[model samples]
Target: MNGYDSALFENRTVVVTGAGRGIGAAVVVAFLGCGAKVVAHAGRDLSHTEGDLLSRVPQGARSRLTLLTEDLSQPEGGADLARQILDRTDRVDVLVNNAGTMGGRIAAGTETREDYDHILDLNIRSVVALTGALLPALKAVDGASIVNTVSISGRSGGSAGSALYSGAKAFVSAWTKTLAKELAPDGIRVNAVSPGTIMTDFHRRYSSKEKLDATAAAIPLKRLGTADDCAPAYLFLAANALSGYMTGQILEVNGGQLMP
Candidate 1:
């Protein structure tokens, strides 16, 4: 056995999309902590969190970090990003399709065709496209894994202004299971992380503290989840030593906000 075999993702190469901030960024950190080399992809040149936050993670950990910027909403963009990673690494053991967009005016007469198209393109299309583009790399790994970032809004109807967002995520959850089986033969596992209202920038934009408190009151956990809380699920899925047999499953991290 490898010296770091018990360390979960030791020596694995992990790619995290939309890793500029929030849960995506947290997942990147988690994978790095597990001894995996991380390729962080962001939609924009600017980071969602401070760039230095990751750079500060100790020199040894920082050595495993690489940042790539690409707009996944476009078909060419996804392919380009995948190619960039392939060019830099021999194999990718884990692919986290965590990059997505939310929020579209969903009120009656407010939803527009353009808004629907944009949300679907970013949240669903990009996930599908990127996964397809990276299939070869994932297949080459001994125990590769893919984790899609879904949302509880996908399972149930979302707030009044989230029709497109919810529908897009619903598609992600369903697609994740299908891909898991299709890729299993190649030793690649596919899964998803569906989070309920979490205290990320995404949630903060849609809700104020008072609003978040009221929403939390309705949840069983009596509080909103944090990015830190949801990140481990991705780490677990990425770590072959931990979740090698787990595939086609949706691990919800919502502070008990939504339960099966």
Candidate 2:
């Protein structure tokens, strides 16, 4: 099959976290277009933007879509989310742990223990815990893929404001590599996508529009990335025919901000 098949995920069931907005929403739409049954989970109630996107799916595809709401940072929440999906379907062909937060208050001596815990809980811990809970369903499929949304900060240290957030994503990147090897025997591939300055509401927590524009200008591509730009990497990883032999890899889609 082609790497970007229009029907790439046909007859597959994929679960995506944080699907109410940004990259998560984009991933859900992409998979749906590829004919996958998507379980879209968001931390809060769906917004008008998300609702509109969902409405665009074809009628026949509507039944293939399921909406879920839950805070995945909690200890029990991860497993609970998995159970909810398993309750509906016997198998999950893909698991995209794309839910994350930008803890932008971690300057020198500014971040407290609570701040550290919250960031880690949302970024690193939730990904690992949720994946562990859903492993069985994923393995039931002949070949499944797990995609984690990491950040450019994870590769290199972040600015003072993003210290803790960067650290948490770094842990995710490292853990993804390890899990890829451990799960290879089960025919499950694990990978991460590290994006830079995406044009999404995700940055509102960290800076104003003016500041964001200035940062975007600093990148070699002279612009910020977008959710659309980053979604294809996840699609690529999730397509078994395209990336069946790939695992433990980090795909950077940062508009040339951090080239390795």
Candidate 3:
């Protein structure tokens, strides 16, 4: 179990949103390593992501990779992505909704409506829309599954300044549970992975080094989780042989930071 499973997803089709960088990028590499036909979806250019992924993805797996760019923040972006995927293939075996944004600290009266819109759109709306758009396709495939990327902030209702972000993720976590029940009969398993403080670009720009160090110290593991650490959880959740009976669950990858 320590070593990677090369043939776990021999011919599976996986769609990983926000695969441009950070955790999203790591998950894509994990899937590709397992012999999946993966579509890496990102809203921005793939200059750095392309390099980051290429270096990690084996030469033999290169042909199985597909880079997709679509802004999942917009209302129609989900439909557009579905169309794009369908045009290329008939079904998607795994859907990873990893595209998300770290919003500015919420100020009660000072925050603009656009701020809330942006945060909710990226963090929550796209997940709902994209999952809905892909529902039938997911059902068509055998052992299909959906893994959503959530946050620790969502569980605690956020820290001092991240109220809006906390709220959006909270909704995502709850929605994940509800979706699991609804899709269970369709043979689609839905689950969420909530990461603690991961050292990704999302934190590099917003989290101070001192703050990260402080948070790391608070964790029982005494370190922040890496994107690589969080990647395998998605595979575990998606692979029916591994988690066939698991659904509507939150697999926390927080280094024992939050026991719940």
**Tens-place lDDT digits, model 3, residues 126-229:** 78888888888899988899999999989976566688888888899999999999999999999999999999888887788998899999999999999999
| Regions more than 4 Å wrong, model 1 | 1-6, 49-56
Candidate 2, overall lDDT?
0.83
What are the lDDT scores of the predictions, listed in order?
0.80, 0.83, 0.86
Q: Give the 10-residue window scoring lowest on summed lDDT in candidate 1.
A: 1-10
Number of the top-ranking candidate, with TM-score as the measure: 3
Candidate 1's displacement at residue 52, Å, is: 7.9
lDDT tens string, model 1, 149-235? Answer: 998989977777888888889898889888988888998889999988878778767766887889999998888888878887887
Q: Name the top lDDT candidate.
A: 3
Cα lDDT for residue 247, model 2?
99
